[model samples]
Target chain A: MTIGSQVKQSLANMKAIHATLQQLALTSTNEEAQRAFHEAMLETEQMIAALKGRISTLEREEPQYKGM
Target chain B: MPAWLEVAIRSICILIGLFIITKLLGKKQLSKLSFFEYIVGITIGDIAGTMSMDLDIRLTEGVTSILIWALFPVAISHISLRSKKFRDFVEGNSTVFIKNGKILEDNLKKEKYTADELLEQLRKKDVFRVADVEFATLEANGDLSILLKRDKQPLTIGDIKPYVPEEKEPQTVIMDGKILDEPLATARLNRGWLKQQLDQMGVAIENVFLAQVDSYGQLTVDLYDDRIQLPEPQQKQLLLASMKKAEADFELFSLQTNDAEAKQMYEQQAKHMQQLIQKLQPFLM
Candidate 1:
């Protein structure tokens, strides 16, 4: 997939994961589950950053893909 | 080990122990901490901090004290987990503030919530009119979860248009080239059907970025391709808007009036939210 597409998918996944973490924050009965959700949410943010970086790099290089 | 490494090891051990103790404490401990919990948190952290750094005092003594004190909350949590009444004792039950469109002044008094706090919570919930609430309760996590009047609530699918449940939706058989073995049986869907569905979509299992059968059992397919699509300005705005809305809703639902409960819940949510915001900050960068 293109870096742009990868960034989009990663962003979407991060959003979903954040939503789930919110739910877990309020609904999870166990403290560890809440911690896990929080950790996963962090990992998602990192992935988003990495993907966005890739997208920006591609936007700078790709000539035909004016979709930047 | 070097001095710094020794300190690091001590810090990690202390952290793990704290984590276990925190986990045993339950949802309210993280979400609705009282003054008592704060004392415990401080005391444990203090001891851990001292243990990791102090050369004169030994680590065992500090850890033992922390563990000994931990047993009280731990035992209470265990009992609460097994028995509903004990749960009520340890975490307290949600008090009905407004039941059947009427305010329960006694409960409000018991929960130490002022009329102003109630109004604030309602405003956060987007309920400007107090009469709009059918039931409002102070949930265990110190949230003012309000159930609005039935007439005021948005109509559900069944209410708007009557129809029986349709066929179950297909599941995402492949995600990032990994077969979800657990979801297959849990969802009562198998590989052959999923493969056929992918075949129709011309999505190779390896190329499938994320495929999950949604709740409706519909296969929601996301493919990996050399395509361009950064969240346009509008989509980005929408994404942020929704996240903000969710946070506002949570603030409304999770309100604690009791000073002890208020402090605890605030700290818990603050710590949790701080971590979350910090994590998301990188993406914002």
Candidate 2:
């Protein structure tokens, strides 16, 4: 997959997870489940950061998107 | 008369101001007051006293004095939050006072407390006999914390002696005037079991306020209709904690005369009475 497309997919996944986390935080009465969701959100955030860095690198380099 | 009244008002206001400033300087949270806090408290008290009596001193002057006295501790607290070095220097670490009943004089000296004072504090903890102590610590806040020797301490269920449960009595089948189906189901006891227990006791579930299953599976129930047996410990402690309030009111009322002896006597007695309530705390719990 192209770097830009991959980044877009990651962002989309992070948003979905973030939304689910908010819902889980409210609905889950168990403290452990809520904490797990929060930790999941943090991990997704880190992944998004890493994916964005790669996309920026792709954009910076001239037309490297095409061949490899 | 208005001028005399204003003067009287200012005097009272000064006392309030001093109290506020000292309280705001924040000693209540900590068991020990630091040197800086102690100094700030004393200085504010002195300034409030002087400013109240001096007719020339304005309210603004008192405010500024209180504010100035207050700033040091606030600043110190802020720094202590961010700086570990400053925190350690301000409130020294806890020191071991006794290790297996061996008195550590050096720690006592560091705490600036005499041996007699340590013994007095221990006695207050009902550990008058030092040999009975296993570990004693001079906590950073100037409080003495003790770990007593094994035999001197109250034996818990896991001690040398063991008592086996005799029988499983009817578990708590109802609480707050409602039948507890879940607990009954979990305990494998049924409605018939509950009905029989209630029938034997000649009381209905609707009258119960609280119910619990003890370790031996016996149901302990408290009823709103029942004249509950509140054992002597609770009654005695409540009685003691409240007795001094009347004395406190008398002392507060006699503040009009401003007699130093009366004030000191009242304060001392109130403290003594409070300590008694504090000692009775375990029983209350």
Candidate 3:
């Protein structure tokens, strides 16, 4: 896979993980478990943002790799 | 029927029949023939031999059988040229076994090739490391076409320095002291210009053994005798070569640029290079 495609896939997976963690945090009764799930959601969101940046950069640079 | 009489008549008839069939089938080298075509050729020959030696089979029947065998292959060849999917089914499409230094194990397995066999093919291309290959494909004829990674490819002058010589195909203008009309037309020079060049050297055109012209309009001549020395290289030819290289570089630059302003500049540069080449053509060599 190209770097762009890989970064796009990572962004998709991070989004899915963040959705699951958000659901877990909302339903959990224990304070510690809720806090852990919220923290996981925050990390996943950050990773998704980083991957979006990488995907944009890679998409811009993709043409330079042609004919190589 | 008399045995000797039957044998002689059958032999002559079969010979004529096979000769006519072969002529209609057209010419193709045995090495280039596909497996089905090869089988068809051999089976036709075998049927002809059988018909010639056997007394039971009628001459007309044997000829008809051979014709049927010949027609299938010729028809298939014609159809294969027109239909790409049929041609791929018949002769097999080229398969990519390696891409971006990664070996596709499923493709290798599907082609019934082992890892060792793939390595052997790589070795034939002088590539010992699998990591050095950017793309390696098995061609339709089972030949391997390998493209190495950019870092592993042989370095050209353009890679080391900023120089790219004009690489034009040498066109033969004269052979055996005879001027070739086609190349003269291709080089865009008249017979009068050639005569003037020969007259300036105190030589006749008939005395020249071989002559070639390059893209830079440089004429390389060889005389039948060893008495006459060739002229030295001129500045105009070098200038033309540089202009040709510049034109090619500008074309490549235009393809690589994404910026609109840079692309316009590159296109303009390429146009100027082409103009320089046109301007320098008359004075070269």
Q: Can you list each candidate's DockQ?
A: 0.02, 0.01, 0.01
- CA-lDDT, candidates in order: 0.62, 0.61, 0.70
Q: How would the candidate models be sorted by lDDT, starting from the highest?
A: 3, 1, 2
Cα lDDT of candidate 2 equals: 0.61
What tens digits encode model 1's per-residue C-alpha lDDT throughout B1-285? 688887888889888988887776667555435545656667777877788787566787887898876777777667866999876676667789999899999999988899999999899989999999999998866778989998899777578544423324455557788889777655655787678767766667887787776432346566677472322223223434444443443243235223354345434543454455544432222
**Residue B52's C-alpha lDDT in candidate 3?**
87
lDDT of 2 by residue, B1-285 (tens): 566777788889877766676566566434335655666667776777777677778889777877877776788788888989989898667799999789989878977889899999999998879999999998766678999987789976447434322223345667778888887776655677667766766677787787655322235667796575532213223333333343343344235324465456445534543553344332222
lDDT (Cα, tens digit) per residue for candidate 3, span B214-256: 5544567899998878785353444446446546655665676
Best model per TM-score: 1
TM-score of every candidate's chain A = 0.68, 0.69, 0.83
Model 3 misplacement above 4 A: A1-68, B1-33, B38-70, B156-168, B226-285
Q: Pick the candidate with the highest lDDT.
A: 3
What's the TM-score of each model vs. the native?
A: 0.54, 0.41, 0.52
Could you give me the TM-score of model 2 versus the true structure?
0.41
Worst 10 residues of 3 chain B by lDDT: B276-285
Best by DockQ: 1
- lDDT (Cα, 0-100) at B61 in candidate 3: 89
